[model samples]
Target chain A: MRSFIKLASVALAGLFSAQSWALNIFACEPEWGSLAKELAPEATIYSATTAYQDPHYIEARPSLVAKARKADMLVCTGAEMEVGWLPVLLRQAGNPRIQADQPGHLMAAEQVERLEVLQKVTRSMGDVHAGGNPHVHLDPHRLLQIAEVLRDRLMVVDAENSHHYRQRFVDFAARWALAIEQWEQQAAPLKGLQYVAYHKNFSYFAEWLGLQRLATLEPKPGVPPSAKHVQKLHNLLEGQSVLAVLTTAAQPTKNAERLARKLNSPAVVLPFSPGAEGAEDLYSLFQISIDRLLAAR
Target chain B: MKNISVWMAASAAVAFSSVADAQNRGRISSTEFNPAISLILDAGLAIYDNDEDYEIAGFPLGGEAGVAEEGFAINEIELVGSADVDDKFYGKITLGIHQDEGETELDIEEAFFQTTALPHGFTVKGGKFFSELGYLNVHHKHAWDFADAPLVYRALLGRQFNDTGLQARWIAPTETFLEVGAEWARGDAFPTGGSPQDGRGSAVLFAHIGGDIGASNSWQLGVSHLQADDVVTELGGHSHGGGDAPDNEFLGDVTISGVDFVYKWAPNGNAKQRNLKIQAEYFVREMDGEFEFEDAANAESGDGNIVADQTGWYVQAVYQFVPRWRVGLRYDQLDSDNQFSNVSFTGFGSADDLIEESGWADEDVKPARSTIMFDYSNSEFSRLRLQYSTEDSRHPGEEKDQQIFLQYVYSLGSHGAHRF
Candidate 1:
């Protein structure tokens, strides 16, 4: 009986060790965090955004640093979007898992189709980019691509869990594909729905959802709209019925309200991220944006 | 001075931190600790060769004031730590200590607490806080466009940053994210007086939302609004409040409003291609009081009551000519009418305010400056900058002064190089 008890104890120790050695994954932005959660429900998840903040300015908090310090995998958005602080976070996390060029580290952009390719890049074009556009996740195809990238990374950290990650990704993709079809069907009637937005951030979504590309609320990409620009937008859309003014939830509604009043339109606030106001999850975020955008009409 | 108090606190904290490290040393060897600490000590020697001698801060000063090399004089010690209080709260502090001009000053740079973990992504911080207003404002002195701050920042924000308050920031749940924060503080913005504000309150509300456009390219756009009231508004006026607002007689009723916009893009991260960043700000002010500008032609009690608007913008381009080497140039300009209040320099018989108000080619006594700078970043930790600046002030001879400063930065305490 005593010998039997010792065997059981040894087996229990091995079990505990296996659990402790689970693959460590670090997803940099919120969507990736949620996707990682969906892929590995039991794995420890470290996310930064919840429902109401900007991902670009997420503090590389100490807790994040501590998490990075031990991470065996790092996943993040690239395109210099995280440039202000991600480099510092990765360097300080003391974990070499996600260092650039490492197999364990991956930037989501490499997996997606680039848009808005700049033929001429110069200072004359206030803040020109060397790469095309970086906001790829607005397109589900890009997110699917990112999922594949993430799946490969998981495979690297836990060869045993590789099958599980791929399986999870497949399942997620099937559901995602179905959702995309639903979105297309729902947005079919809303094709060419005209609106003005505070930022060009929603362009990919607008394109995917079949929303018309009207004019931006801002005069330039990042610059505020002057009265003259507002007048110009009005002039350009003279023949079209601009149903509403749209902006992200994080944006102030002042300028949108002003423009909406001029056009006799309703000012609408859409969640740019999953879990922001109307967006409760990544899957529902796009659906709701397209659905509500049409409903607002 | 508050600087002395912060230094004392930092020293004590460092000593305490060492104790904690010694206890943790059992898990890790001291060999790992040595390199971690060396990041805290760096020194430099710079020689100043200004065309003229000057006095700043009402002190007996001269034009040529070059001391150490353009970077870290010595010992840029920083202690980064996080603490858990009970199960409900957690706090982080990044305290820095440096010896500048032989004074051991302490910067309680960043300290904040989170109510929850990364899941909620909500946090609140109170203490001497750093304003995330502009990119450069948030960059430590160790990382900057020049050895010193930009001219607009120094003149408008007073050398460092907006401080003396609590700020809360949160992130949204999406692949592309949005950030928003609000801050409240007691401080004077521009035109420093004999003392900083006492018991006055102001607020800054800001938000940034943008996303990745596609592969190899990413973009972000941000906007911030700052409003300050009941601030000590003494600019040789019987002035009242803060930024680009209108002029007043007693200045006790001016509200300064400032707005900022920023955009940045880089391919394959912020490197492997040219990276460009553009930032602009406009400040407008309004007052409820009458203006008593004795210098005004009208001489009306509310003569300076007219609102004043000012703007500043810079387009900087950085192209990595080769691996590990970058050359960049930035052109910055600021223009304002009634830059401060309706206070006229000739009225004060010193045209200094007039010189400071008008753009480069505007007022006879107007003072304005524009600069083009080229920077050479040796590595993540060191940089050398050569800037040629031209000041076309309302004042004839004092309008222009130019210099090239070599600034080098050495990081101590394990701060990592940032990548986009």
Candidate 2:
């Protein structure tokens, strides 16, 4: 009986070592963090920022830098979406493995097509990206493409578990295809609906659902709307029947509330990304966002 | 004529290949190799109750302390360019334009190249750059909360000191943030005057450790030491508290040691809307050498072997209750002590009387200043500030100087985010 107990102890030790040896993954946003969780459930994961914060701007805190330093791979929505802070974090982290041009650095936007590509970029246009719109994760079809690319990246960075990662990708892709059909059917009523948005964050979602963006509350991207701009928006809304004024959970509600009150329309706040406001995963994120839009009507 | 034709043909071939290359890329972009450029402009108006000339007693002044001449002035226009030189290095250049004595002058504030990819988390930088000795020296004038610099900084290091140097830093592989750096610089500035060749003038060693306290607070602590040879203190032209002029010289080795601490609180780790920061630093300087005084009227000289120790410190706190508004308060103080031996007077006066008249006979002079500032930022690129101060920075005997300032700072183009 003593010999049998000794054998059991050795097996438990092996199991714990395998768990400890899992790769460390650092995701810049919650969307990528949820995807990494699905792809590599056994690996340790850290999400740098939550959904309720603007990913465009952030402080490179020391805790985040520590995560970046020890990470085997870095995943981000990089089309200059995080132009304000990511470069400084990467530089300060001083981690060569996840630097640009390396396989460990995977940018989801690079795997899919982009919209609003500007021919002449200028600051007067108010913070328009040179690499086009970076909020492509909302498009289910594009997310699948990004998932495939990320799966391949994980294989390249952690080849010891390439077989396990590949199988997970296959399962995730098959389930994601079925879910896209369901979401499209559910969101059929949103087509041709006109609405106002706080910013261009909902461009991909609107494009996928066939919704018409009549006007923006913000004067420009990343710029707050002045009183004159808001007044102009109110005048436009008076002439047309609008669905609602849409804002994200990450944004403050004061401007949208003012617009909604003037227009007598319902104000809708949707979860812009995963891991916030009951949108804990990719599937639930779309469900919650579509349901909120429908409920506003 | 034959050789000229041959050269022309070669040039024509070179131009043809370049055009072909451009066509192959399928674009006509002129800024492909251009670096990131930015410009910062600072303009301010100062109102002073007493316009008498002012200087910190027992300290040498070499930086901008004139405070805009008590009227509307164009403080500075700073232009910066930065880029990655290659996969392994980065380069930055800054030019500052200011009005001095009714003439506009341009100065290169910083020009440096730093390595990005080095083994063992090591990085090296070389060129003319601000010494990362204190909390505020690395930050520019536009980034300051108040319109004017702190009294301690103006007295201890002449507002800010930048030198041509080489620095090497290493980040330890640990959970916390730990960085250790050393610099070898040309000590041709105030507080440290020596040769620029072979790095014999000045050397510095510094270390900083930082970490987070849960999700709401973060803190950092730093200590530094700087040593230089053949230091000279020149304070002839600067008048302190309505005092007469005396040509004074201090000679010997100078050493300065400093300690700094910073603590920041941001509720739920979201600093965008609200936050509070407290920062403080203490500096002590020692000069072991001789003091020489010259009477300009009689051409008489007095000499004494003296050792001087000077200390200064400042504490400041800033709070942002809303996204676009902030308020800050700062207090600073300076103290000095001089011990004299082997005193000799070659002038037509007694040694004690000469020392007393020259402002070195006293044990030490302590002066302090307090300031309050409020600023409104419409965006990250621009800010307007109002500041008021009650200061007795020149001498302990003089009454405090009441001052007010209104300033504006604006930035245009691509400006990179600063480190915390």
Q: Which candidate tops TM-score? A: 2
Model 2, position B180, has a per-residue lDDT of: 88
> Candidate 1 residues B274-301, lDDT tens each?
4555555544333333223332243222
**Per-residue lDDT of candidate 2, residues A1-297 (tens digit):** 999889999989878866642777889998999898888988788888877677875777667777777777899988777767787787767676677645567777755677776778777677677667888888899898778777766666666566788999999999999999999999999999999999888888889999999988878787777778888899877868788898877777788989988988888888888867899899999999999888877
List the pairs of residues colliding in candidate 2.
Answer: none
Interface DockQ per candidate:
0.03, 0.19
User: Model 1 clash tally?
Assistant: 49
Candidate whose lDDT is highest: 2
Q: For model 1, what is the alpha-carbon lDDT of residue B416?
A: 38
Q: Name the regions of candidate 1 deviating beyond 4 angstroms.
A: A1-297, B1-50, B53-119, B188-200, B233-265, B270-309, B339-374, B397-399, B416-420
